[model samples]
Target: MKPSFRLLSTVAAAALVCCASSSVLAQSKFVLKLAHADSADLGTSRKAVMADTFAKEVKAKSGGRIDVQIFGAGALGGEREVVEGVKNGFIQAGLASGVMANFFPGAMVTDIPYLFPSDEVADKVMDGPFGQKLSADFNAATGMHNLCFGEVGFRHFSSGKKPIHSPKDLVGMKIRVQETPLYVTEMKALGAQPTPIAFPETYTALQTGVVDGQENPIPTLIFAKFYEVQKNVTLDGHNYGIDWFVLSDKFYKSLPPDLLKVVTDAGKVACAEERKVNRTFTANGNKTMADKGVTVYTPTAAELAEFRAAAQPPVIEFLKTKIDPKLIDSIQTAVKDADAKK
Candidate 1:
C-alpha cells in the first residue's frame, strides 16, 4: 500500500529528531554539576575560577565527551547542602570548606590554630603524603572522592567594635563562629565569647551586632563584602583554611579510565589556579580594605606569638578527644618537615 505524503513526511521528521537526540547523548557522555557558595563573579571569586577552569579543562581533555555545569553563589544551597548533595550523588562535585569536618572528624586537625607556618609549608604538607591519606580517609568515610585540597587562605579576625592587637583585644567580644565545636572552642581559648552562627547569616549578624565580629580569609571578607559592615581587620592568620574538591564516588567510578584520568588531572590544574587567584587577593586585600575605610592591622611578631600561644593549646586539647592524637602529631611533624626542606 502506498502511504500518504503527509504520513511519510511525519515519519521522516520523527526519525531526524531521534537522530539529533542520539547525537547529543553521544557528545556528552557524562555531566557534572559543580556547586559552591562563593559569588558568581569569576574575576573576583576564586571558587568560580576553579570551577570554570575545571569545566574547560575536562571538556578540552575529553574532546567533548564530558559536560560540566557550575552553580555558584549558593545556587545549589550553601556549602553544607552542597557537600551533602555530593555525598549522596545528587550533585556530582562541590568545593566544600570547614563543613567537611562534620563528615570526617580527622579533617578538623587542619583547623588547629597556627598549624602551617606559611603558604609554602602548607602547600607541601597538604599536597604530600599526608594529604593523600586524608583524601583516602575522607573518601572512605563519606563515599565521596577528594580530588584536591583547595585553599581558602588564612583566616583573620575582623570586628566592627575594635581593632584586635592581641588575644586581650578579643576578650569578652561576641564573635561569630561557624556552627562547629572546634571554631567555638578556638574562639573561647582566644578569650572571645564564641557565638555559633551560620555562614550565610554572618554578615548580618555582624551588622546588627548579633555578633561583634567574625573570622575568615581576606578574599572571603572582600568578596562577601564583610568589610562593608565591619570596620576593623586583624591579620592574625589564626588558621589556614583548606577546602576540598569532592566528587561523588558513584559518579567518579562510572567514568571510563580515560575520562577518570582527565577529571583527576583537571582537578589539580583547577586547584592550582584557585590558589593563585586566592593568594593574589590575600596579598593585596589589606590595601583594598584600607581604601574601603576599614582599619587593617598587622600584628607585630610578639603579638602574633601571643595569639599562637593562646589558641593552639586549647584547640589541640579539644581535638585530642575527637580524633586520634597520632593524627595531630603527624600534622605537626609534616609541617616541620615542610619547613626544613625549604
Candidate 2:
C-alpha cells in the first residue's frame, strides 16, 4: 500500500533531522583544548603565534574534524599546570617551557649554558636525531607526546636596578628564575641569588624588588612587559630556550592514523612558523627594547665567555648527579655536529 502524502512528508522530515545530527557529529570528531601562558592576540608573540598557527592549520587541514580551542594568557594556568593537565587528559595539548624539566629531567640537557651559537645550528640539532630521541624518551617517561620543539629564542638578563654586562654585575642580585635546579645552579655560579618564581608572579616580583632581575628571551621581555619594570637588558644569550608542543598520550591514541598525521604535521608547521617569528623578533630585539627606554647592552665576546666559564661547570656537575653523563655528552656532540654542517 502507498503511504499518504502527510505520512511521506513526516518520514522525509525525520530523515532530514537524522542527517543534520550526523553532520554535526562529523564536523567535530575531536575537541582539543590547547593552553599557554602568553598573549594569544599579540601579533608579535612567538608563543601566541605558535598556538594560533597550530589551531588554524589543524582546523583547515582536518576539514573541521578537529576543533581547537586556545586559552592563552594563563587562562588555564601556568605552564606547569597546563602541562599537568595535558598529562592527565584534562587538556589535549599545551606549550611548556622550563617546567618541562621537572617532568622530564633529560630536558635539562637543552639548558646547558652556551649550547647553540646560532639559530641555524639550534634548528638543525633540535629537528634532527637528537630531538627525535629526546621526544621518544619524553613520551615514554611522561606518557605525554611531544609534538615538536618550538623556540623561546636565547635567554638574556633584564634588570631594573643595574645593567648586567658581566658576571660581576649579577653578583648579589636576586634574580627570578624558573623553579629548576639548572637555573638555580647557573645563577649561583654567576654569584646571584636565584629566586624561583612562577612566571605570572615575575612582573610583580621585579616591581616590588622581590627580585632584582630575570632572564628570558627578548620577545618574552616585551610580551610580558618586563621591559617596563626592568630597564637594563643584557644580551648575554645565556641559554637557548625551547618550548615543547606537547599532547596527551590518551588524546593522541584516540586519533585515527589520518587524524594523527594531521596533528603531528600541523605541529611541525606551527613550530617552524614560531621559530621564524621568534628569530625575527630577536634579530630586532636590541632596538625594540631600546625604543621602550630600556638599556640594551650587548656583552663583548670576552664578557660572554666569562659568563660561560662561570655558569657551565657547576650546572654540568649538578646535571651529572641528576641525569646520565652520556646523555649530556650526546647533546654536546649533537650541537657540535649541527654547527659543523654549515
Candidate 3:
C-alpha cells in the first residue's frame, strides 16, 4: 500500500523529537514529495529512474537525513498542475517534460524544430553551460529552483496509415500535438493539420480517427503503446524532447546547507544515469517497435536535410514574435559553442 502523507509527516515529526532529545541533537530526517505524470511500468521513462535514483542517492549522501517520496502516474496531477504544486510548495519537486515550458517561455527556445542536429548535439548543448543558464533563468522567473536537465530524446511521427517519408507525406494529415504553439506551428509548417489533444486522450483520438498520427520519442511511443494503434513509425527527429528537474524554492531553502548540496549533487548524478539509459533505449526502441509489427522508417541524409530546412522557417518566425530576439541569439550562440567543443 502507498504510504500516506500524514503518516510520513508524523514519522518525520517523531524523528525530529528524537533528535531534540539527544544531547548532540543531530539533523532530523526530512521528507520530500516528488511527483511525475508517467506510470511506473514504463522501464525506459526517465521519470521513474530519476525518482528511484534521486531517493537512493540523496538518502545515501545525506546519511539518512533526507527521505524522498515519489508519486508517479499523475497520482499528483498533470505537468501543469504539478508545476503549480511545486510553486505553491504543496509538492517539493516535479519531473516534467516540454510541457513545463508553457510556464517558462524561455524554455520554448529548446523546442525549436530541427535546431538539434543529432542526439550528441543535444547532449552537448543541454549538459553544458547553455543548459545551466536556462535552468537558472527558469528558476528565477518561476520562483522554483531547477536542479538538472534530462532528455526525453527526439520526437518522431507515428501513423496508422501510410508511411511518412517526407514533408509532403504529412500534407492534409491530421497530426496530434501537445497544446503548445511551438508544436502546432511546426506541424502546420510541415503541411499537417495540427490537432491539439491532451496526452491521456491521444490513444482514443487515434482509434477514433480523430487524428491521423502523433509524434513522440521512441520510449514514449513504446510506453504509450502507440505501436498497437500505429502501423508506421518515422524517425523524422523534428524536435528534441527535454525534461527538467524542478524543485520548490520554499522547500529547497528550508533545507540545511549540507542537505541542499546533497539534493543538487544527487540531481547531477541522477541526470547522468538517466541520460545513459535513455540513449541506450532510444537506439534499441526502434527495433522493438518494428518487432511489434510497426513499420519503422529512417529518412536518408538528404531527405532529412530537406525536412529540417522545410520545418525551420515557420518556427523561427514564430519565435521571433513570442520570445526575445536576444535570447534566441544567445541560444544559437550556445549551440555553436557546444558544437565547437565537439
Report the candidate with higher TM-score, 2 versus 3. 3
What lDDT tens digits, residue by residue, belong to model 3 across residues 60-92? 998887879999989999888899999999999
Give lDDT: candidate 1, residue 44. Answer: 86
Clash pairs (backbone) in predicted model 1: none
List the pairs of residues colliding in candidate 2: none
The lDDT, on a scale of 0 to 1, for candidate 1 is 0.91
What is the lDDT, from 0 to 100, of the residue 163 in candidate 3? 97
Best by TM-score: 3
Ranking by lDDT: 1, 2, 3
TM-score of each: 0.87, 0.85, 0.88
Of 1 and 3, the candidate ranking higher by lDDT: 1
Rank the candidate models, highest TM-score first. Answer: 3, 1, 2
* After superposition, candidate 1 runs with Cα above 4 Å error: 1-28, 208-210
